[model samples]
Target chain A: MHQAIAILDSGVGGLTVAKEVMRQLPQEEIVYFGDTGRAPYGPRAPDEVLKFTEQIVEYLLQFQPKMIVIACNTATAIALKHVRSQVNIPVVGVIQPGSRAAIKATKTGMIGVIGTENTVTSGAYPRALQELNPDTSVVSLACPALVPLVEKRLYRSDMARTVVSQSLQPLLNSPIDCLILGCTHYPFLAQMIAETVGPRVSIISSADETAREISTLLHHRGQLETSGKVPVHRFFCSGDPETFQAIALEWLGEQIKVSPVFWQMTRLSR
Target chain B: MHQAIAILDSGVGGLTVAKEVMRQLPQEEIVYFGDTGRAPYGPRAPDEVLKFTEQIVEYLLQFQPKMIVIACNTATAIALKHVRSQVNIPVVGVIQPGSRAAIKATKTGMIGVIGTENTVTSGAYPRALQELNPDTSVVSLACPALVPLVEKRLYRSDMARTVVSQSLQPLLNSPIDCLILGCTHYPFLAQMIAETVGPRVSIISSADETAREISTLLHHRGQLETSGKVPVHRFFCSGDPETFQAIALEWLGEQIKVSPVFWQMTRLSR
Candidate 1:
């Protein structure tokens, strides 16, 4: 029997990471939980995120997820430490995998990080970058509007380009060889960001790196799912199941069997 | 020659209508334009929504659509008159068909219209209802968060239910035999809204009625493209093209090809 991995995020941004894990770990049955109701965790407070994360983990544990991947940077930064202490299973956050990838990719030692305002304020990426490579210089900017923009399905247009340029104006002056898309949603806007920031700056996606990290950790810990014939990936959103499934099929390039699940808080209230 | 119909919206909600149109008219081609960059027109100022509508219509005219559908209620209310005066093609807004359907469905002649804040604020549905049946009572409520909540993909969660409940609280007191889902996005939340509003209220969807209207109009005008082997439906989003294509396939429910196009401001840019 193959072990199941539970991946949770505030919303669809984590799907990027989950898809990558599916590609790398073929045998594991992946369960995804997206908190679409209070998504874009960047602006949210730490305690709120911690509580949300706990609820998701507990929900996923009912299915016996062998490991829990906090696929969101904002939640991982604030909640992972506390979550690790409580859960018996292994927990992984995107910051370290992304930080390692950025440290390795940058030749100029100067990297640019674009994330939500709260994620930048958290100083999570900068700290991880510095810890990995002390001499590395990081220029971080919070794109306050980008997440909402992307969430609304706006990634093309002069307006989208204008917003991208405006958000990235400060980072342009720095000589950075690599740009880290600190938010998972940032990758969807990679084309506009790349055009504005110039092609020389390599765009690093945390989704890819985090997926790789999950596989390596599972292998080392002897928790890897080694058997399964055609694993099924189930996606549950606290939002529109159709839209989530649609975007997942597009992003994952697979006919994902997505079904609607009702999160009955009233039942839990009893 | 099969004439192409121009379907425009502030964003992806219109795709629901467009998908229906494609299903109903197989031989006819559709040119869908979503102003994804600055979407959720329902909450936007009437003037801004008007400007957006005009811009998209002007852009779509280059494709020479036989008719244009203002798939957005906010845009339809604000700009339908202006668009009709300027364009030679027949203009259809989701409002009239939906209002007509609600009026016909209601036994007590009390109709409730639920849509975005701007749509309800503009009194579009009320005006449409009164124009069709002067004696009918109209109750309108602004569902400000529903569009964004749906756009973010949170349709089936406790949070979604809570939001739906709160938004519909205003309508619960009013006696309505028929409830009109005035926005295209509203249909995605139909099941939940119906469950909350109870089984007594007959839920009216604008998309289905709008599709029927287009069929009738095209048939009367001799623009119906019948006897073709298969109809081609082309979807273009000012966002992630691949993502749009995937969601379209799921919504479209048939093996139809979806292609991407750049929303260029100028001819030279394209």
Candidate 2:
């Protein structure tokens, strides 16, 4: 049996990454764990987010994935290093790929980033961008209200436009030519974001870049699936399975059955 | 053993479709045959194109594919129904999906289509658009020169820009809000095409839509790969393996090994 790629996130936001992984590396089986029960890790403390991420990674380890993808921006900002140290297999995060894309996409060396408050405050994007190109100018904003709208499935609603417009007003004033949808959930609001920023600004989503990185890594490691077989993707949500399934189907453009993953604080040791 | 999705085209043009299928359904093994030796089916007689398509289909049938995708526009325009009649498995074409995407994308109902001389002359897109939405006004241009440029790997060259500018000059004059890269190879010149048409026109490529259609068909038929394994993709070319391999790697974003598929005129009867 080929080892699967394990991906974990705070909630359904990670589904964006999973969708891209499915698109770019369709042959690799995926074992996805979305900690939807205690989701919206955006507002949570770093220690709490790190703890939850570790717990989910430990849970996913049972399937013996060859690599791990931290699909959530908040969790990645807080827990990527900790998770990497804890896991024996390769672990990837959304930040580096996203930052790299912004750095490459920006013609003016002026880039803007939008994410949850925690991720923005963490300054991951700015740090990554500056490290990549020292002369780059990074402007980041925290759209704290956007995730809840997404969770409530109001991404296509008029209210989403208003929210996106108001949130992006500051960034629009900046001279940035590229806007990074720093949070995975922000991709759902991409249309409104695009409309608000107009065509001049390129919206960079980490999903595609992240998927490419995973593919390149798998190939170089000789872990890419080369057999003639279709991969079975497994989804586990610590929250409502039905809700997760619906969103997964919508985002993936296919019918998918999602299973519930029950966890408790006491089960952390196991 | 899992069955592969069989895709055939006149030449490397189908690599665009193959690339999308890999991105959208990465887990499913693909058996791709490019009839490159006798390619540029665009200018060939319909009967000759049909006969070549049938022979490729017959050769691919040996792989026991679960479905067939006619990735070439000329083949799709002329031989889709014939191919479907010959094969028992699910068969998909690029024209309908591309037409549907154009319909969905166009706000002004004024659409532009660019393809080889055969596809444009066949009136496939115009007919498809009219059949779906009579209100749609379709403008098509026969880009007879573009394919050879692609075959010779001049897609990103200054010559490509000049060629694209010349071909698109008529369409740009029209009120077309959306332009369809009707030929599979046209996607290679997408940047040049987009530059010629400017940012107002949405460039529609059938690759993603075709991949989605295949996914939907496979899922509905309960044929989606649910196994936790990696799929190995096979490539066959009735032309130069080295040339095909170079293009495949560049287009697919991975290093792929290509095998030669020799054909004889006498074997048509068998």
Once superposed on the true structure, which residue ranges of model 1 sit more than 4 Å away at CA? A156-159, A264-270, B1-270
lDDT for position A180 in model 1: 90
- Candidate 2's C-alpha runs over 4 A off are A1-270, B264-270
The residue-by-residue lDDT of candidate 2 on B73-162, one tens digit each, is 999999988887787898888997788667656778899999998999899999877654566899999989998888777787898889
Q: Show the colliding residue pairs in model 2.
A: A23-B23, A26-B26, A26-B27, A27-B26, A27-B27, A227-B232, A232-B227
Please give the lDDT score at residue B201 for candidate 1: 92
lDDT of 2: 0.82
Considering every candidate listed, which one attains the maximal DockQ?
Answer: 2
A1-270 per-residue lDDT for model 2 (tens digits): 589999888888888888777654556789998887777989998988888888888888899889999999999999988887887888888997777657555678898899999999999889766654556789989999899887777888989889889988887778989999998888888889999999999998876667756764564355877554677899888788888888887888988878886654346424
Query: What is the per-candidate TM-score for chain B?
Result: 0.92, 0.96
Q: How close is candidate 1 to the true structure, as a TM-score?
A: 0.48
- Model 1 over residues B1-270: C-alpha lDDT tens digits? 666898988767787788666544545688897666566787677887887788788878988889999898888888988998998888888887787667656778899999888888888888766644456799988888888776655665679888998889988878999899999888778888998899999999887667656755564355766544454656665555554555555556655454444544343123
A223 in model 1: Cα distance from truth in Å?
2.6
